[model samples]
Target: MPKAGRRRSAVWACFTENTASGKRRVLCLFCHHDLVANPIRMVRHIVRQCPNADEHHKKICREYQALTVPARRRPVVGGQATEAAKSADALELESARVHSDASAPPTE
Candidate 1:
């Protein structure tokens, strides 16, 4: 049969018998433990929780976890307010300025 999606990651090599029902589950190669096939849980199991997992598997799991982590968002500079909050504050100030200018009598 043709492939269904992208090739599975090398990290999945540590697991097998991936079965789908209400939730997907896989068998850990090192511990023979059945676990949800979610990547984070798999990595955690191999790296920290699996008693039977060796250094090699733990190293691989750590690398996979590092790779899968979402990139850290850039921090807002100089204040606690985010960009959207600053924009909203600016807009409010601008509208107030415009409203005040409009209400003032015209000068010669």
Candidate 2:
């Protein structure tokens, strides 16, 4: 058991195939879709699979991303995510998407 003031880590490795090299990639907890690795992968995932992803999982991912550095920086796991965090995450994600689309370059 961990002592008081000390916490457990939530990071887990998810093995995925690298798009370019066809090699195995080990992903950390923070990078669920690997958008950080290759921006194009982020676009593809958002287009094809993410739309069909379960709502609950999407909520969790949003909450995890929107979580502030200080709050999430502390390692912990298995506890309920804060409702405030969930709501904030949803709003932030929506805003970000809107801004991104608005600023994107147009193609002929």
Candidate 3:
């Protein structure tokens, strides 16, 4: 299907299912090239030409590398943690609350 709005010009892509995550993502096959052309042809062009298209790919690679630092994580500027960490922390809080309530004395 044709993409809508601004992204309408962006390329359409289907990510192969990740074996570990079992999730898929859509992406632009071409580097910095929008999906303005015919969908099937666009997909083909992206596969064949996007990797070496221009400086945009280089920038994307640099950004991706920066985001994947293992030694240190980015500071939570607004207290927003990654989704996985947030879910685990929520579970811990829930368990603590349950235990506290369960162990407390009964009241009239």
Candidate 4:
């Protein structure tokens, strides 16, 4: 079947069973973390694993980070370009709702 979106992290696969409301769950083949039915969150979880994650999980994370060519989703403000910085800035803006929030984005 044709893919809906770009290929996700190599460490995880989506299983489409056991859904009360007919929703699939993305399972991490590495560290088993239960993320909601959101692909972006799944990717974030894989990329930003806990500090004490197992060596295997860390190795997979590093490999994926090196392999994937990240696109510039948000405009670069300062020289430092990192997800942590973006999330921090996002948190600072009380007016800005999270991506996970179902509400529509604030109109400019």
Candidate 5:
């Protein structure tokens, strides 16, 4: 059973206890396929790969996947030079130019 406030996966509905293995394994209600009590495999089986799975089961499995999977961070473009670093470099260049101009004697 899940904790009082924690979210539970809807894909759990597709699982039934394996009578032979007891709690060690679960049987798929859709295709009667036996699987170990592994959440990743269960989700994959129900969501993307299960030919026997119905639309309802797939929908729930997708929901579970969405909750569990962390969104991928987009890769930084063009080597290093992040936006902050680029801005800082530009500011430094501007300040150096200004400092050089200020130090120089006034030209007529």
Candidate 6:
């Protein structure tokens, strides 16, 4: 499925494509390296994980990280994703959307 509105789109902005397994995926803006689409993708790429992340990724990462960083880490498998992380991210995105929707008038 497509993401929600602006809040989710910030995380989606890092994406390049989706896998056959129904997971939307992202490539490092600095290196075009592929990974699952999530906020931690920003944190991992901006921090220690991605060797190619640079200034561009840093700004995007920071923006998305503020919206979606989970409080804990999920086990990673060869840099691949798991369902738990996806669900947590979904929850975060939903939470952000609900909060925004309640606090502001509908844009259109």
| Displacement of the residue 65 alpha carbon in candidate 5, Å | 0.4
Candidate 4 lDDT tens digits, 1-108? 797997655455422223554566644554444556564555456667544356665566566656564655765557855554467666666445554355866678
Q: Encode model 5's per-residue lDDT on 1-108: one tens digit a residue.
A: 656885546667888878696567888888888888677678988887677898987887888788888866555578865555456678799799999999999999
Candidate 3 TM-score over all chains jointly: 0.25
The lDDT of each candidate is 0.81, 0.45, 0.48, 0.55, 0.79, 0.66
Better of 3 and 6 by TM-score: 6
**What clash pairs does model 2 have?**
none
Off by over 4 Å in 3: 1-34, 37-86
TM-score of each: 0.56, 0.26, 0.25, 0.36, 0.55, 0.40
Error of 4 at 62 (Å): 2.1
Candidate 1 vs candidate 2, lDDT winner? 1
Model 6 poorest ten-residue lDDT run: 7-16
Tell me the number of clashing residue pairs for each predicted model: 0, 0, 3, 0, 0, 0
lDDT string for model 1 (1-108, tens) is: 887988776668889865655568899997789998877888888888889988887898898889897756567778665655466678799799999999999999
Q: Which portions of model 1 show Cα errors greater than 4 Å?
A: 1-4, 18-23, 71-108
Worst 10 residues of 5 by lDDT: 80-89
Ranking of all candidate structures by their lDDT, best first: 1, 5, 6, 4, 3, 2
Clash pairs detected, candidate 4: none
The regions of model 4 sitting more than 4 angstroms off are 1-9, 13-21, 27-32, 36-43, 69-108
Better of 2 and 4 by TM-score: 4
lDDT of 3 at 25: 28
